[model samples]
Target: MTNDFRILLKEDMRNDETGERWFQDIEIGSVFFFSVQASTLHDSTPPALLDDVMAYEAFQVTLQIRHGVYNFGKRGAWQHLEDKPWWPLFEAESPVLTVAANLPVATVQQVYEDLVACEKAHPEMTTKKCLRSLSVC
Candidate 1:
């Protein structure tokens, strides 16, 4: 993640510019690495420890754990509030790709291929090819 992203919560589940609650300015195909922070919502009525709470689900959210390049377009078209309730950058898909949390691979490539394709549908991606290098060590 390049730390160049923001999380916006939309009001209506459906796509309606006037009805949406929040909107994030992001490139259409750009991919982002994001994770919902575990949260605890507590209630105090009988002086109990707590009641209400929110937590991160196991595998409920998929993280590609890769870097993405920038493109042009609305972030709303690529992301939905239903899939990622806590924040933006959450997509319904499998995050393009994913790897083990233990950093199984030292480097990853084509993190931006999807975004690039979405930006401009061309055969160059498959023919010429674009690659990205990541450092795990």
Candidate 2:
């Protein structure tokens, strides 16, 4: 038995002006989200936390995404908040792909492959605009 998880594409949106794309995936009743945006001059957040962050000039895959939640007593039954347990599978510059924690290496590779395929199928939606720099490592 394996605890590996997979993400199914639920929605995809892009901002033509900024070249920023958002992806939402369904997994275990929650949405796994990520984005790819064009690089910019005043990027406050370093793409990768490292001594030489510039080396990762190709792109940046930030593990930062809002976690979906269901609040039974709230007016809105569901909300996406910044507090989520999904951790980065690897550093910013790593060519190796990863998702949430505790997943096997093979599972991470599979997820990366799936994402690449999706990007290839939707070339226009992948990176057409260039507003700000963001990436999927």
Candidate 3:
């Protein structure tokens, strides 16, 4: 790998599910930071501190995304994204996404116009871009 990969997207493990909580589709040269943490409850009562406990902290600094799968060890934990392509690494179902801030509002109208033109030029492409709230690529 030539040391260039940027994080296209990432999600933290906010709920219980095994494995690391990071994903990316970066260019050939980029740098990013991922702050990872793990915790467990102790004693099931007040004063949640105890000696028999496990704790982990790390800065997954500067991951380089080459064209193949790479697995870094996390205390023998199983990674959900193992052996999967970048897109499939995303959960099977789409998350309930809030409107992304960077998608320029005006671009929607422009894209619609382009789609219309494309359909006119090639009648086979006349499918609707919006079908049941999912954008058709």
Pick the TM-score winner: 2
16-39, model 2: which lDDT tens digit per residue? 455344435432212223332212
Candidate with better lDDT, 2 vs 3: 2
**Tens digit of lDDT per residue, candidate 3, span 21-120?**
3333222211111221122221122212222212221122222222121223331111322232322222222121111111122332232233233323
What's the TM-score of every candidate structure? Answer: 0.20, 0.25, 0.19
Candidate 2 lDDT at 17 equals 57
Candidate 1 residues lying further than 4 Å off, grouped into runs, are 1-30, 41-68, 74-130
- With candidate 3 superimposed using the best TM-score fit, by how many Å does residue 102's alpha carbon deviate from the native? 3.3
**Backbone steric clashes in candidate 2, count:** 6
Ranking by lDDT: 2, 1, 3
User: Candidate 2 clashing pairs?
Assistant: 18-131, 19-129, 37-134, 38-132, 38-133, 39-133
RMSD of each: 15.1, 15.2, 18.6
Range of the 10 consecutive residues with the lowest summed lDDT in candidate 3 = 94-103
Candidate 2 deviant stretches above 4 angstroms = 1-99, 131-137
A best-first ranking of the candidates according to their TM-score comes to: 2, 1, 3
